[model samples]
Structures are given as structure tokens and as C-alpha cells.
Target: MKSNLVCRNRETVRINEYIHMPKQLSPAQVEQFWNDGFLFPVDAFDGVQAKKYRNLLEEAERDHPGEIHAEHRNNAHYILKFLDEIAHHPVILDVMEDLLGPDVLLTGTVLFIKEPQTPAFVSWHQDSTYTGIEPKEGITVWVALSEASSESGCMQMIPESHHQGILEHHDRFGENNILTRGQTIEGIEKERAVDVTLKPGQISLHHVRTVHSSTPNRSDDRRIGLALQSFIAASVKQTLGEDYALSVRGQDPFQHFLRARRPQSDYEPEGIAFREAANQRLSDILYHGSELKRDY
Candidate 1:
């Protein structure tokens, strides 16, 4: 499993030979991700560590009234350094690198939080549909900050649906659907879906074309999950618009994206401006040529 990767300025280096790569995801789990279109319960952080992140998010929500709402949550990693740290966490990078090779780029991250007995829920859809990344060269790592169970609205995926490629999706704009456009697919058998349950500090990885959604939270506690999108740097290109990606591991010789910088502080004026501009561009790409522009 040794290979040479090219970095910026046409430089080449051996990934495994020079770097201390951790074996996070076992071969069985990797195979499951490919075969079942998703793998869950990958231990990422401990319960104590998870609580620290949850506290930060709660503090942010309390500090800024509506700033953490649906429209602003899409790219929260770029706006806050703490979120960015989690996205670039060593454990997460190791798993992503194992699947996407050494050259990995973080495209975007969105925080989906469901309140107790709330109507908020995600509709069934594929991430590749609106992502605009061709050839389905991406994986989404969903990290749970709190316990995620069927009762708390954990994500559910249809096994082997990713092999069918991208399916037809129609925008319904459901009132309580958490998805940006309320996009959904038809003819899906709900009974075939598997709940991707995870304890606090665990995560689930799914392919870009996987058909997935979440139910409304029925428990009293809040359900917090961060959806991180990772792509191989070599596969990145200016498909819909300028691709804004942060290289988390190895090097990106392709230069296909606008390299994002680390934030100095959470919600700084300059960082907020940059995050807003980048998010606007992404929304235009994901919601382009469509009448329905649901806030992400």
C-alpha cells in the first residue's frame, strides 16, 4: 500500500515512508464502507472530548442569537477555529486518508442539530446530486457530538444504494425538512434503510452518492452531528464554481481549489466575511438554476 504523491510545485514524496500514519479504520470497516455505502461507530473522540466540543457549540449559540441558525451553519468550520480543529483532527484525517489516499482536501462542513421533539429532519437524498463534484469522488464523515440513536434522529442509509449511482431527486421543500432544498428521491423503501447509530465521540462515513436521511428527534436531548465533506485533491476541479478546500493532509498539486486559511479566532470580522463570501458561492452552485432556494 505504498505510493508516491505529488505535492505543490511538482514535488513528490512518499506518504507512508515519511509520515506516521495511524491505522484507524480496519480493513473490514473499509470494505463495509464500499459494500454497504456506509460504515458507522468509528470511535473518534472520548466522551469527555466530545463534551468539550458540545460546550463550545453551546457557547457559540448563546453568544450569537441567530448567527448559528440554519442559513449560517453550512461552513461553520471556516468561521470558527474550534470547528476547524475538529475537521483537521488527526483521527479524522487518518481515516479519510486511508480511504481518499494521502492527498485529502476538506470541502465543507455543516452542523445539523435537532432539538428535543422538534419537527426538524433531513429528507432522503444524495450528497453528490448538488455537490457538483463529478465522478462521485468524495466521502462525508458525520461526527456525533452527542449520543446519536434512532430515538435521537441519527442518520439512516440505504445499503448498496451508492452502487446505483446518483438517482433522480425532486425538490419538495418540506416545511420541517433540514436539508437546504428539501430534496428527496422517490420509490425508496423505508424498511430497507439502516439506522447509523453512534455514541458520543463516534462517527459514520458514507459515500457521496449514498441515499440517506434522518428522522425527527423524539428524545428530550438535542442531537448534534457535524457533516464533514472530504475529497481527493487530485479529483478536485472548478466544476460549478471556484472550489474552496482546505488541505488537511499531504499535499495538493492540482491547485483546483481556493485554499482556505485557518481562522485566528472564532467569528472574527474578517473570518466571518470570508466565510460568508465562500458560502454564498457554494449556495449558488448547489442551488443553481432552481427556483427553490432553501437556506442551508
Candidate 2:
């Protein structure tokens, strides 16, 4: 057992390699996730593959500036082949199938990156606050393409907060906030927060209603994470307007929303239309019931 595939970007990544990393959660681990609302450090791939994907992402940023910029960051897989491949990754989906059952649908992805020494941060919020899905069984599988350490402002979760069942949230639309609506849940116990530090190719999965946020990056390297969000059970239906998702796994008998296809290339017609419809509906859903309307 010499090949641990340590992520070179962080000293702790190598230190953590000796520990057992399972592609799928154990029964006991599964119980803990339900009880705690979040689980982390699930092995999805090796650091070598992670580095390759990182390079691909940076290359895209350099070559095609606006393609993955702004709101495009939300559904990046529509334009980038690597992101699409990552979305449909078998190892990651195996873990998803374990938690979400055989019939899984992927709504979209969000690429959150914190530049070194930047004040950019996500406010405390539950994803269920915006995503208008019923039954609330959806999960967000956040995959780290780079080192996600405490110094890098890794996500911090309020354990078992999903049990609180979508607490009240207010919108700030703050200057440095990275969230679409700058949505925030007030009054969290900081003493109870758990830092979800991860290394390249590792992933953290959390319930849709889990309360979470991140601090600003203090480290020299940019912290990059691809959130494969809204992995929902086939039985769940959209409570808001029309939405779209790709059936990444088994059959979807309910058919709550329109089925989206993987883009053949960057900015193709079908993909563009799919993204426009889904994103527009998402905006309305997230901005629903807000008294203060602000440009996001």
C-alpha cells in the first residue's frame, strides 16, 4: 500500500494519505452523515488527475475568458468538456448513488474560487433556501480541484443544522459576497462550526438544508472547488418554475422538470437555451419573496 496519491499542494494532504479513503461511504459513515448533515474527504480520484483537471481549468480561463466567467461559472460543464466529464464522473456518481439511491439527477454545477488574499467569501446559508425542490433530499457534492485548507477559507459547516429545516435567511447582496443573492442565515453558534478542509480530488457531501459558509482565503494559492449541486432523488419535484437536470444515473420516473442534455460544444444552441431557461428560473426562485430587489 505505498501509493497513497498525496496532493502535493498541501502538507496535510500527504499526512492524510495513510488513512483509509473510501469511494463509497460505509454504513456507519452514512448514519453519521444523516445525523450530522455533512460528510467529507471521500476519495474520488488521485492528486495527479486533480492537477490535470486544474491545469485544464486554468487553461480555459486563460484562453476563453468569459466562457466560464460570471454566471457561466454556475453551469460551467455546459461549455467545458473537463467540467462535463467531472460531472458525469463514475467514481463520484457511485458515491452519489449510495446516498441518493440509484435514480439521481444532477441539476448543475457551481465553480467557486477564492483568489489568494482576497476578501471574497460566501455568507452563511442553506442551499434549500434557494433551490425549490420538495422532500429536501438533495445533496451538494463539492469536489476540490485544488487544496481546500483552513488558510484557504475552506467551507465550515454547522453540524446537524439540516435538522433545523431551512431556517430564516436574509439577503445582503454585499460587495464581497460570492453567493448569487448574497443570501445569509443569521445567528449561528461559531463554537459549533466544523472546518471542512479537503485536498485535491477529495469531495465533501452535505444535505441541501445544511447550514454552511467560508472565510476569505489567506493562503497564496487560489482555492478552487467545483460544487456538483442539487443531486436529487427522482421522486422529488420542483416547487418553483420550470427547471432542468441531467439524469446522470438510473431511471427518473417522476420527471419533475425538463431533461437537459450535455452540451456538444461550448455555447451551442441547445445548451444555451437549456442554460437560459434553467438560470432564469433559478434567479426567480432564489429571489422569490425578497422585499429588496438588487442586481445579482
lDDT of 1 at 144: 96
lDDT of 1: 0.81
Index of the highest-TM-score prediction = 1
Clashing pairs in 1: none
185-293, model 1: which lDDT tens digit per residue?
9889999999999988998998887899999999999999999975554556657878688888988888788888678988888888888887888899889778978
Poorest stretch of ten by lDDT in candidate 1? 1-10
Evaluated at residue 256, the lDDT of candidate 1 is 81
Q: TM-score for candidate 2, please give it.
A: 0.88
Which segments of candidate 1 are over 4 A away from where they belong?
1-22
| Cα lDDT, all candidates | 0.81, 0.81
- CA shift at 108, candidate 2, in angstroms? 1.2
Poorly placed runs, candidate 2 (over 4 Å): 1-23, 267-269, 291-296
